[model samples]
Target: MEIIHHHNLAMKTEEEKLPPLIQAIAAREIAGFDNANNLHLHDLKISILDANEEQKQVSISMPSSPIEVHVGSSTLYPMSDSAAKFHSQPIPNNNKLKYQRFDSFKTWSGKLERQISNLRGKPCEIHENDDIENLPLDRFFDALEGPELDTLRASEEIILPENEKWPFLLRFPISTFGICLGVSSQAIMWKALATSDSTKFLHVTPEINLALWLVAAALVAAVSAVYSLKVIFYFEAVRREYFHPVRVNFFFAPLVAVVFLAIGAPPPVAGKLHSAAWYALMAPILCLEVKIYGQWMSGGQRRLSKVANPSNHLAVVGNFAGAVLGAAMGLKEGPVFFFAVGLAHYVVLFVTLYQRLPTNETLPKELHPVFFLFVAAPSTAAVAWTEIRDSFDHGSRIAYFIALFLYFSLAVRVNFFRGFRFSLAWWAYTFPMTGAAVATMKYADAVPGAGTRLLAVTLCGVATVAVAALLVATVVHACVLKDLFPNDMAIAISGKRPKMTRKWRHRYRRRSSSSSSTTDSDYCQGN
Candidate 1:
């Protein structure tokens, strides 16, 4: 029996080159044969085709005899030119490979195209040389252009997802309650100026005080309604803010604003409403005081030294403010109780801040406005003591002097107050300034003199002007600029990535990359 075997292998490249394709075919054929096999060939022929479609052939005729053939096998597996090129290249690490898979899938499914289209008119360029698989995470961000780049450049700002119905509202921060606190405190200061006998010369009328209180009430109602919506819609954000070291202090501001409204209630509305409001809010304030004061004294993550900053004075100021409202409502024991707790904590906080303990976290320069809080606590305490005793005696005067000294000290460092762009934090200046002014009015009433009267008038004027300026600036920022609710600190602390940016598109890339061990927790904690 005679058997003949004819094997044909065809290979082609984009260029349709003859030499490389023939070499690949030969390699594949030789690799298939075992070294131990013996074969006899009568005729051997090789054929090649070039890009032009022209064929060249070679033929060899062997002698009419059976020829033994033994071919050695190759250790390396044979591959086509393209496969060889891919295999020869260096393999990326697991992280890069994972990102490559994700990018490939995103591109295949057209999700990437949909995202780019959602950017509207923003221009993005992908160069021909750019390998999406091998692109560095940072370089990918750098390649982004137009308004998309601007959105990333604004480090404090973030774009909300398209699915969100009210993106602007979601960005609102808990610190915005400081606005209510400042405005209501201003109403109180104006009422003090209008009602007090010593300052009757300033011509502050009942109508002016009434208007301020009305405006403050309107602001408080508006802010409360908006924040209630935020709490319902974004409870996780609210929960994170509640646990924040600095921001948790501002939770006291909303309650304090209500208390101020009750204390400074216009003559037309002061009778039963003031007492009812005070009684309703008293329990929550004391409960918060116990939880916060306990945390401070217990020595843990929320300990005083770890979290102490000028903002902690907000929690201190609330107690004194509540004490003043209690005294006004004819509650004797409750007023003294609140006053005692406030005084005890204020001393420890004051000394902690004054000594600048190494363990204490420091505030960013943009938040330096809260330093005025040093003035707020003592001044509120002085007023609280005066209300509790029904007279501005030695104890009230001592606290008032400390506040006055700190106010002047902070006032001289003009550079500290200036240079920062307007923010919700600027409201920190208003309530504290108003508190100091209220204390000064008490001082002027206690000791009538030219110097004391002038100082009283000056502080009241400054507080009024500061509150007015901040109010106007906040309006313009919200209406014209439309950037009043970026929630910088909240976003930073909560570890939520900004939406609609390329940075978040490859979040998995960042996670998988061994070179980038940074996590959301690390980023949030570091900030």
Candidate 2:
């Protein structure tokens, strides 16, 4: 035992004699090493890298000293729920301390590795998200307009039908009313022809006057035929207007009655038949007056501002025309009633229209029914008054004077008249002008004055010139212009196209093809 103890002391003395640096190097070479192939980290209950990768609380025994954890060369602080992993080889329990420096070149790489689990538990915070739900909806709505505010308003457009649009001869059936002028002028000429004393002033014989009556009668027939075509083709338009709750359309009724009265004066079977028709028509005309007048009063004129044109007095003119016809037929009661109604209603209409109607410049010249206000109503009244009283009485004189003054007012604006477009409304000028001429002749005969005779002669000359011009224009428009039919009714009963329509259609086809080609090329370029 003494020898064994002496040998152990000798070996310890030799190892203690070795260099200190060699001994430290030998210690480091034998120390435990952690590497990627064998090292792992897990929780007490589960591995963070498990298939489910669910997070759970882990109980770990913390060391008093700090730990140096390495993951892919990244140095990390101690994890809150970490468990140290070791290789299959057991590490020596030594108290030796060691330090190692990391090189910049190999900074992001290491022999050891680590895996992160439970990605949902360590989600990165987002700075901003522009979801629509996060917008200030209440603030936006508060800035909007209120419910009472009107975002849109209305405007008016004159949408003329293709038929009534410009470049048509029979654009409107209202032109048929021009028949009244021919009939009235003929009646006056016939009266003058029958008077032996009239030859000196008129410078025409009874035979010439008879020929004029025949011509006037022919004109009446032509107009009636044209109007019949209008009724057949445009029944709905005529019916709607005829029964409208307004008095202007009522004028056309009396115009028909005037034709009957004119024909009745000649003492023939045709005259008797026309007179009978006139008598039959009187009842319906009276009914129409009552309906229109009653509605005008009751409705308080809902559209008065828009419709208060001088045409409103046309109703009054109709009554007077009826009175003249009734007197010619020797109907005492009818003439008196019609005359009174016409006079009273016309006064009211005149006052209202004068005050309320738009200015001349504001009104379109094509729609100048206002000219009739000064001419037709007063002249018709004068004629009716002369028939009732059998002379130029106070009422007849007053009516004549008013008619003359109104005529002058229109005459002074001759340039305006010339500026007017060719429309059915031009027919308005014919009736009033003829009526004035008739009134002048009646006044001259009743007064028996030189000045009156000269005035009568001048007016008749003017009426003749006007009628002749209108006739030429009508024939030219119908034959040459070929615009006599309204739109779709352009084809005649014989199924022949109008000359103008054939030309227009050819032009339309050429333009349409050119426009279509241009549009197609434009579309291709755009695409």
Candidate 3:
């Protein structure tokens, strides 16, 4: 538990004969247990009050979890009498310095080997927390050496496991989607949709600007309604016990949820879509971890425990990048509104699959078919609309169909080639999910002249039964796995029951008020 900056300090605990010059911290302060034998230590608290200017000696100690703070300024050199002298800076007498990594140390570590590189240097002065939620520590260290890292300590509540840094080790892909959402295709589509609808525009109003606003709001509202309803339905599935927030997303995923209105915030900054979605996707994950952290901090409200992993967070990063790509391509030709809405729907599909996989947790053989549904979902959504749009206007040359056809087919083959085996149940479940996407196309198009009309309906029917069965089976499975649940599935009940919980608390308080009054009277009479 002796946390030292340079590799000059061996991993061995306090083996030196001389007392540390500063003794800035002690082992007992950080790890309360005399766990001098454990592989790694936690509870990294060190007091560095003993810096001796005359001796140029300093010491710092912290658990090697969350962050590894390295003090580049400190230096150690071997003495003639089997002792090591410590210095605050590179010794002038010996211009050559040693660079330490973990255990062993090498001599002279010349300027080039010991050189520091900061490619993504901060242009402006480092603000207190310009990007608290997205600290980008690697970028920070890349900009400054170990000594400078101390100046950039974060105030944000980072929730990563041991040996990681918040905003840096976190795998959330917020920037990508946030940027995409900021420059949302839906916005452009509404503008185009209005311009294209010349007849309606002419009929609308005397004021040209007013008419423009109406069209913009109408199309925006239409697409927004679609995505909002999507969120509602997906959550309702969980509310109805079809999805378990904890069991599905037991690990902290990144923020992948596009919760535009939930926090009532402005459109995310460019490049933040990916990061935001990662954070959103991991919202449940983080809260779940917070519960673990809470129990530990509170000395165990419950003796039971929940294992932590970063599966969903990694998935959010992957999917946020993926969702953005799907959105950009999906909207390239069709009404951007349709493309964004379609991509948003695909997000729902991912949220479901994400419920099953870790953010980057390797896929299990049993979940192989899941990849088909994974590849097929966005591809199919992109294709379904293109198929309809193509049928109505033979002249329509939108290449969505070709792109989706090629992309998904290639993706599926890649997954299979990668040797990810799917269980028979996956085939049984996914083909139906695939069928639902097929059937979903027909529901939107019933025109007589449409070439894809009948085929769409046929796919719709097949997918309907498949999706229904999958939904039923999924819901049952989500509810039945109590071990997967937080507090035995507390994530489910804790998720949507926040308000209901408040109401129940109020009711309990009211009843307690009267019961206490009666008890007081009885006590007085007894007295």
The local distance difference test score of each candidate is 0.68, 0.52, 0.31
Q: Measure candidate 3: CA RMSD.
A: 25.3
Candidate 2 worst ten-residue window by lDDT:
148-157
Name the lDDT value of residue 91 in candidate 1. Answer: 39
> Which pairs in model 2 have colliding backbones?
none
Which residue window of length 10 is worst by lDDT in model 3?
A: 488-497
Q: For each candidate, how many residue pairs have backbone atoms clashing (under 3 Å)? A: 0, 0, 48
Error of 2 at 70 (Å): 82
| Candidate order, lDDT descending | 1, 2, 3
Candidate 3 ranges beyond 4 A from true positions: 1-370, 373-391, 394-458, 483-527
Tell how far residue 454 is off in model 2, in angstroms: 0.6
Q: What would the TM-scores of all predictions be?
A: 0.65, 0.55, 0.24
Order candidates by TM-score, high to low. 1, 2, 3
- Candidate 2 error regions (>4 Å): 1-172, 179-184, 193-203, 229-234, 243-264, 267-278, 300-306, 358-361, 483-527
Residue by residue across 49-127, what tens digits does model 1's lDDT show? 5545666554433333333333344233243223221111133448653333222212232335545756876544543
lDDT of 2: 0.52
Against the true structure, candidate 1 has what lDDT?
A: 0.68
Candidate 1 displacement at residue 506 in angstroms: 21
Give me the overall lDDT of model 3.
0.31
